[model samples]
Target: MFKVKVYVTLRESVLDPQGNAVKGSLNSLSYTEVQDVRIGKYMELILEKSDREVEETVKEMCEKLLVNTVIEDYRYEIEEVVAQ
Candidate 1:
């Protein structure tokens, strides 16, 4: 079995209003050190195959269909799991 962790985030050129709101709230709460917060999405995918080739293929599928590469960046990590 294989596990894939995907993180999708907006590019630096894009403005994140939600992130800015969170940062503002943090500042109001006296957390002055927090600055420039960015919001993103996280996803975990479980793949039934263990082959490295299959894993690469799955990663490509995610990049092409699941994520929008024009305005967002995505990264994924694959891990092998022991059978139960």
Candidate 2:
């Protein structure tokens, strides 16, 4: 078994409206020190062991469905499931 952690976020060159809204609210609430705010998505997946490489499978999933490559970038971590 394995556990996968995926993180997806807008590219630096892209605009993030939600992040901007949060930043604006923080500034309004006297949080001027907050210069920038960016929001992202975190996901987890559990799967049975397979003969195929987990890293390659996960990368394909991210590129095809989990992330929008045009305006977003993604990264992931994989951890082995230890038996209790």
Candidate 3:
């Protein structure tokens, strides 16, 4: 079995209003040293053993649905699961 982890984040050039809001709230709570905050997403997918290449399949999934390539960037890692 294989497990895939996906991370999606806004592109550096894009503004992240949600992150800004959280940062503002943190500062109001006395976290004044917080310089900046960037929010992103994390996802886990479990894949059954197959002849297909994991890298290619994950790439297709990310580009087609999991990420907005125009305004966001994504990266992933795959790990083998040992069944008991």
TM-score of each: 0.87, 0.91, 0.92
Clashes of each: 0, 0, 0
Off by over 4 Å in 2: none
User: Local distance difference test, per candidate?
Assistant: 0.85, 0.92, 0.92
Candidate 1 TM-score, C-alpha based: 0.87
Candidate 3 Cα deviation (angstroms), residue 6 = 0.2
Q: Candidate 3 overall Cα lDDT vs. reference?
A: 0.92
Predicted candidate 2 versus true structure: per-residue lDDT over 1-84, tens digit per residue = 889999999999999999999999999999999999999999999867672788889999999999999999999989989756
TM-score pick, better of 1 and 2: 2
- Error in Å for residue 22 of model 1: 0.7
Q: In candidate 3, what are the lDDT values of residues 15-37, reduced to their tens digit?
A: 99999999999999999999899
Clashing pairs in 3: none
lDDT of 2 at 8: 94
Among all candidates shown, the one with the greatest lDDT: 3
Quality of model 1 by C-alpha lDDT: 0.85
